[model samples]
Target: MLRFASLGSGSKGNATLIESGVNDKDTRILLDCGFSTKEVEGRLEKLGRTAESLTAIVITHEHSDHVSGAGRLSRKYNIPVWLTVGTSHACRDNDFYETHFINSHADFEIEALNLHPFPVPHDAREPCQFVFSDGASRLGVVTDLGYYTPHIISHLDKLDSLLLECNYDERMLLNGTYPHSLKKRVHGDKGHLDNKHASELLKKLDLNQLKNIVGMHVSEKNNTEEYASNALCEGLGCEQNAVSLASQAEGFSWREM
Candidate 1:
């Protein structure tokens, strides 16, 4: 079986755990480790797992909220970390862990799980999203991207599960308390995706095999669970309960594909 879980998802911090295989051969990977070592360990414990049990760590970018504790976790548990060359250079302080530079257009494998990383239009040095497969089921995770592109749509096609970013509601973001520059940054081409854009992207994807649509990286102040859920539901033409939101604290529990 192929399954995944998130430690948390937001500007505060982010981490996701993907697992595949059965019994003794099971392979577990931490997609991103943004929390402190103890915090990540505790979150993993909630899913009946531990950092020591992880097979590897794959970093999406050098943004603090996405890579804060990746180095510590990898060093503490002696787990290998995969990241792009630019991200590796951008994160000079996190040089303690054993690192493997990955190509954004290439595909790689870690035991039973196959990962394909693709570039995304984000402000970070070299941001990317991933798609994972255990030979049968595919899980696509696309967050922190500023906008959707045809390449992204092509890669996310036929996903069994998806964790897409729904960072904010347009009106709320423009009218919220954030400073002018911050607002522009969050709404710019290199900024995060708003609810409408996320919904539009979903409508463009092939959902024939999609079993779950998870809204992730939602803004705590600019977005609400209701709005994100409603937008996704409208785009998918599915019931509200069919969509799930990945929270800033509890995130959602594991779901199998």
Candidate 2:
């Protein structure tokens, strides 16, 4: 079976563990490493994983929130780290990882997981989210994008599980305590996704095969789990309980697909 779990996900940090294996041999790939090595290990332990379980570390971008611990963890564990060329250059200067530059638009297979990385619009060096499959089921991770594009929607079509971003509530961020400049940046084209945009994206997608849609990367200051879950469910015409929420503190438990 194929499954995934987030170590933690938010502005503070983010990391996802996607594992595929049968019987005994398993291939585990970490999607990002925003926390320190110790913290990542601790979270992994909670999820019944360890550093030795990883086959590789695949990065989404050079942003600290997504890559803070990637270099250190990969180097210490002697794990291959995959990223876009731009992201490698951006992180190479820091001297953290042994890098493998993968084409953002290409499809590749690593053991049981078929990985497809597509470009995303965000204020980072070559940011791209992923869609992973193991023949029977597909899981999409589409966070940190400012807005949904036709390419992204098309790529995620017929996914079994999705870790989609719902970063903020428009009204909450606009009228919250943050400064005007900060708010503008958060709402900019290269910034985070809001609830309305997320809802619209969900409405436009084909979710017939989607079993678990986790609302991820929610802002502590501007977004709440209830609000995001309700909005997504409303858009999908499903019950609110049908959608799950991943918070900054613990994220969510391992979900099977």
TM-score of each: 0.98, 0.96
Evaluated at residue 73, the lDDT of candidate 2 is 89
Candidate 2 lands at a TM-score of 0.96
Regions of candidate 1 where Cα sits further than 4 Å from its true position:
none
Task: Evaluate model 2: give its lDDT.
Answer: 0.88
Q: Write the per-residue lDDT of candidate 2 for residues 1-257, one digit (tens) a residue.
A: 88899888999999988988765578899998889999999999999888977888999998888888987888788888888888887874345446678899999887789999999989888899999998889999987988889999999888899999999999999989999998988899988989899999988889898988999899999988888998888878998888888877887899887
Q: Output the worst ten-in-a-row residue range by lDDT, candidate 2.
A: 91-100
Query: Among these predicted structures, which one has the highest lDDT?
Result: 1
Query: For model 1, how does the per-residue alpha-carbon lDDT over 1-257 read when each residue is reduced to its tens digit?
Result: 99899999999999998999877568998988889999998999998888888999999999988899988888889999999999988985566468888899999998999999999999989888999999999999987989999999999999999999999999999999999999999999999999999999989999998998799999999999999999899889899999999998988899999
Candidate 1 CA-lDDT value: 0.91
